[model samples]
Target: MIYFDKVSKVYPPSMVALQDISFTVEPKEFVSLIGQSGGGKTTLLKLLLAEEKPTEGTIFFESVNVNDFPRSKLPELRRRIGVVFQEFRLLSNKTTFENVAFAMEASGRTPEEINRDVPHVLELVDLVEKANHFPHELSGGERQRVAIARAIINQPDVILADEPTGNLDPLNTWEIIRILKKINELGTTIILATHNKSIIDSLGRRVITLEKGKIVRDDKEGRYVL
Candidate 1:
């Protein structure tokens, strides 16, 4: 469903963030991107999202060349993808339910659809009882779960999770990973970029390792070696 072909991203002067990176993610697949900091894992995700332009080669989402798309078309492309961040990027003012509803609202979904889907997604993340709670009232794990619910509310075909569990404890990290796996089982393609070796080692899923701006290994049912 997604392909990166000979893609390279060169920053100003001579800093190369990604060098000739190439990979494909099929539908409903759970793929882990494991690398140390500044290994181009995040840069590759940005290039695919058209947030950063690649200096060479192309990225394809299905048949369309992502690099060739105009900026106006980016929102349309992004709606097909969802993103979760290391810090749970929740609204300080909004409650848990409101936070998730905000995404559907931004998508131009009606109040009726928002009401129906928001609760269901909150339930998926086991946050329905705390739907009225503010981000400050929640634990780090709860806040992150709310973030995940918000990301999946629109039913994006692919989820780009960048260090989603970085701020959590071990049990919470496992909780987040379990939820991600559940989401994958429900048929969404998952591309997880993480720094946690224990999480990666336990996954037993396809892992693509990046090092020094290049792919060093690609394995099926892989363990954490770095």
Candidate 2:
């Protein structure tokens, strides 16, 4: 459902985030992007989310050239994809339920639809009981779960999570992985960028390794070789 053709991203002067990266992710696939810091894993996610444009080449989402997506149509493009950053960008002032509800509201969903979908997403992430709590009131893992809920509240076609377990302990890390696996099984295409070797090893799915903005390895059932 996603394709990158000769994609290269270079910042002003010469900071290359991705170089000649080309790949295709079929619909419903679970893929892990594994690499060390500065390998451009997060940069790839930003490109896919259209947070930044490619300095050269093109990005296509389900055959639509995302690189050329109109500015006014960004929301439509974003609605099809969900993004979760390592920082768990939840609004501190909003309750967990409201945070997820806010996503639905942005999509112009009706109140009835928001009420119906918000709880379902929270339940999916196992944050149903904590829906009334604010970000500070919840533990780190719970807060990330809320972030995941908000990301998926719209039933997005692709889920992009960048270093989702960056701040969690081992137990919480596994919990987040389990939820991601469940979401994948439910048919949401999952693309996770992580530096955690054990998680990628255990996942045993397609893994793409990037180094200095270039993909050095692409393997099925891959290991963390970097």
lDDT score for residue 12 of model 2: 91
Instruction: Tell me the lDDT of model 2 at 137.
Output: 99
Residue 78 in model 1: shift from native, Å?
1.0
Model 2: how far residue 124 lies from native, Å? 1.7
TM-scores, one per candidate: 0.97, 0.98
Clashing residue pairs for model 2: none
Question: Which has the greatest TM-score?
Answer: 2
Off by more than 4 A, model 2: none
- Single out the weakest 10-residue window by summed lDDT for candidate 2: 119-128
Candidate 2 positional error at 109, Å: 1.0
* TM-score quality measure for candidate 2: 0.98
lDDT of 2 at 13: 94
